[model samples]
Target: MFWFVDGEKSEYSGGRTAVEIKSWCTEMTGPAVKEISSRKLAEEQAGTKPICVYEGPEASTDFEEIAARKRTEFTFYHVAVDTEKPTVSVQHKSEEPVACDDLTFDGLKKCLDDNTLPLFGVLDGETYEKYMTSGKGLVWACLEMESSDDLEKVADEYRPLIKEVAEEFKDQFAFLYIDTIQFKRFLEGVLGVTELPTLAVNKKAGDKLKYLYTGEMTAPKVDEFLKNVLDGSIEPTLKSEPVPSSQDEPIHVVVGSTLVEDVFQPDKDVLFEVYAPWCGHCKRLAPEYEKVAKKVAEAGLDDMVVLSKMDGTANDSPVESISWEGFPSLFYVKAGETEPIKYDGPREAEGMWEWIEEHHSNSEGLKERVAAGKAVHEEEDSEADKGEEL
Candidate 1:
């Protein structure tokens, strides 16, 4: 991955006046960026001078060799051109205090600590100061749905006007952005979010977001959606579905609520997972579930997917419904129907990703709804936070 920073780090020694890019290579790769044909290509591509750092593999055990009366064979310097190195010190990055609209883990925690009024769009960090102190205000989350297109695709095809729309809302609200991967999960079935950019606002655990913002998010469009949802003018899109697509959908199992309506919701989705936690397959899906959650959070699409978890293992938390046929089963959902998607074995990231790509949601697979739900269940059911639902 490429990371852009104006400042230098310990690994980089170039002076601040010139732009520089650094690379590293493990023993297996010889040296960082060494495989490249030209350092100039890397420099040109990075818009900065390029440098590589390598740590030679050391396999010679001189002490043991001497004791055994054997020559101390060495594997040092197998591939090397430079021996010179520089030592530099860089100040560790300091974290700033969380702001009300920061959208960071720390910020979420601080808002929970400091707020006397209602707070919304809360992320990972949280506190109990308000509920204990005032007892009336609630923290709400206003999330944007994950889209199925990449940044550029969204730019070129799906929502060409998002950048401008974002610029307008930059000041009015904290506009967390997401890429195509997240959008794919969001667009899978009808979530009433037929439009490209969708928003969800929630105040409680069981409640689906009432306030929404969808379509080309121009200032006026955003205002209209928000005004309607927040003012109770626009009823939340409960049975709303995204525009139908040619793609296959995820296993749209519904839990808690009747499968009366179709869009895959979190509580409903996890029910598929929780129902058969002991299935050797569900256990295998743990890490993949994590990948989905981490990606959604990193992409700033956590709000849109509403990825929550339930542990079928726990007595208190079991998959509310038993789709035994759906257990170890995969499917795509739409409208009010559920279609079984094939799964090779236990639910895993690659397996699920492949299923999602071919079947429901975006082929890009940015939002791992199943995985996210698994993680949510794990975190919530852990001994410490068992009573609290995130």
Candidate 2:
């Protein structure tokens, strides 16, 4: 690394070779830095930019890590590059096998760089910087080994397994990963991963991580586990990001104090179960509500019912929503209207769903499964036809 010297300065034979930049921390480099900076006082020691600043002791458990961060001794190695852009690659140092999908160190940086718009690495760097600074949506996964050697050996063995499992689940919707930091996250998140090869599924929920499962790692096992989760065979102990409220669209969680201002009126008949958490009948209809939330989705009420829970408390009356004078407020709100056709019934999830079938006689969802104009209640129709014959 030759110094940038003036051409007019003919007496100077040439510039100096690679100067080492040094920084001193108040915790570590007191005497050594003082000795080095004192040498810079001489004219021969000119044109050296040693960014020496005192960094106070950080809240760290590992001294080696602290030292590693502070002791960045860069040697000017020769490499031809058109641009002065810094490159990044993610390394997963894990014991348990890592999943390829979870192996995002490289891809993440690439995505950021591409989207950063002419600021290849800088925008990406900004994203990471924002994460580190604000501590927003940050995920930190760590593991402790007997030594660094032990960690390396674990990584060697676990990476392939991760790759295979990730491949198996790639077609599916779930994001499965078991790499270095991610693997460690699985262990810690699943509450002390006891097994040698542990796989943890964590879905990001609002402001917190919802741990799906932490157990033995296998492609088939994970496949079954993921299926069960989707089919509702396994009721997720921790509330996940509320799996796909609408097909092929991102989920939108109902935050507190949000009124459904954007009214989506259904062109066809729509069924909706207005539920409140406090209603005693609503408690009875909890499982029923789950069924309703599902039925509405299945019915493809993407814009229909709008899946809203308006707080009907006297103090906070949301959007002039009519209270279920009955137990389970089963109401069918016609599209483009402030009112819904009240399907008064036992305020329950099932009852709310069933009410639509009984009243409308027009199964909006059933039409898709059946023929275009097939009968909504063929069973009742047959009975009525038999009565006429009798």
Candidate 3:
């Protein structure tokens, strides 16, 4: 029977009911029974759509509201308090887990190219696209520590637990690993992961739903946490807070870490700058960046193309997510793509403006901007030539 304890500590409530929900769940799904505390926690697990039992004191009324809000996707069993043999009304629903495999980023791409499905394993930078863009799923990604002994120790400790849990629930989840030394940019720069040997899950619904494991690193603790995750007992911690919205500036100031949603999801063509405030180069380019923003706005491509900046040096702004080679580095994001397109062009206002026009999807508007810009340049040239002739 499933126990629904009220306090933080989990405790069993009463005896087995006439129709036990846990037994029924085990029988139907083969050992997938989980004990949960509240309806709110259950709803968080709705993504995975597990069989959730709410036996809290308020189980009677709570499950009904949750089932309705969840749109009848998950199977719910509510335990009764009044009777020794509590009757459970099972609401059945069909659900499937997101399929993933263990491969490096490039290997993942090759699998995609070859149209093959992979079993979960350690991943590299190239394979980031496979998991991040899938739109929904769980990726239990771990950052490997450096020292050989420490690395071996973590491997020795986690390998068994990962192997055991992943084998049991392989169909329902994807497990991935990364060497912090190799794919330094992928996690630290892209995901804002500061803690070494950290495990984070991408819920894939939104950036807000991506959570990192902040608990102790023991195998049992980790196992419990993963179980909690699988059973929907935990909510995802945000990778970065919501980038505050404002309409005041021509350049969209990326005040926080909503890069995946604000930049990637909508898939607007973007010329984004990652800069350190202390860097002289970033300071020098700041004025020109704003000018480029204004020039793009003037061309009426602000909606289609965005010019934005993030302070890579800020405490909240993860240096990992920005992962720049220098103080100020620019990346262009194309519409409908998850991977960033690196910008190697000149950083001047006119040069940046021309690049935006070159990539802009509005062909006619691009032509108009090009012609107008050329006309002004030609006029300046003609005047200069006249003065030289005189």
Candidate 4:
């Protein structure tokens, strides 16, 4: 006789009666089984869907092949179990099938969670967040999805080419098509896509560096663009204001095109400030930063040092080591060093001067200038004292 609990086989006792078996089950499971049954009943009453699994015999090769072929079309996973080799593997659409290292229930759940996203699909709000956090680079085809017949024709011409490239690089990157009208702001503001049928790639790690494709939309051209992005041969696209015609203020103005020349000078120590025009913190720090710049100029340190500022909202820094999460970010780049040092001290002029003095590489000319300035100050103080005595 078999004892069943909650539709699952529990135990077998050949000599026990029904009453004895019921008593034995209650004694063994105690309150745990009752609690589980209550929860299951509540879920069923609440219309919660249960997880479904499909099983086929080990000898069913036809079923396995069909499942493998249709895996990308459906939401369910196709797991192939090899009875002879005793291995479990999941099929992928464009890449080789991945073998599961862990066969436990939790391990299989983790594997499914990791590989659930489609190889290529339309990019939407929900899928954007998922793909960006998946640690994979994304290739976006920005097309006019709901526009006129002419625009629709343009999209139709490019969609197939994008899909072909996606299939070829499926294992390296996740490809997606975006609705240009729906994501117009993002395209213009972030990716710098002013025209329709634009293609871009975002390497989501670290700084989320992005590159734009400007070539004709063909399968081979798109493939070459993606290859250039992966191999680091293409320069990342960045938002930038036009370079200033003249920068004559105490604080030098910097833009994306002039970043390497102005703020990253190898022969001079540079203090750079990145600020947004609307930020209250940047507004408050403005006067103090101006004071610091004037002081640097007055002290005859302009030759050895440079003070510069950039509108962070309107421009992007090309320096690989420079990035900020907040406005009014300050960085100190020493002479001959590309790595920047963040300033975390007080925002006042004197505090900034102290920080700069401590960080700047002192040369003989700088030392002589400091000494001469000190001597002139001492002479002026002595002359004032003599006037008081008279």
Best by TM-score: 4
Q: Candidate 3 lDDT, tens digit per residue, 1-390?
A: 232223222122223674564554344443223445543454455432334444433343434443333222234544434444322222112222222142333432332322211334445443455545444455555656665335435555566556555555555556666666666765665555777668776544224245578577665776777777777788555344445656588877674456555556363687788787689988899898899888767756666688887775542332234445466878887777666777878778888777776765565666686588779889999999999999
Which scores higher on TM-score, 1 or 4? 4
Ranking by TM-score: 4, 3, 2, 1
lDDT of each: 0.34, 0.36, 0.55, 0.65
Superposed by TM-score, candidate 4 places the C-alpha of residue 259 at a distance from the truth, in angstroms, of 0.9
Best by lDDT: 4
Task: For each candidate, give its TM-score against the true structure.
Answer: 0.25, 0.25, 0.39, 0.69
Model 2 Cα displacement at 303 (Å)? 4.9
Off by over 4 Å in 2: 1-278, 298-306, 318-330, 346-351, 358-390
Alpha-carbon error at 359 in model 2, in Å?
4.5
Candidate 2 lDDT over 1-390, as tens digits, reads 211222211111222343322222222233222222221232222211112211122211232222222222210111122334322211111212111221133543243222211101111222333222332221222223455446545544544654555445433322222233434553443333444444333232122222244555565766577656545566423321222244442222332233233222445444444445567866776666566667656655544344444333211212335434443455556555667566656556666556655544345554354333245467778989999999
C-alpha RMSD by candidate, in order: 24.0, 19.5, 18.8, 12.1
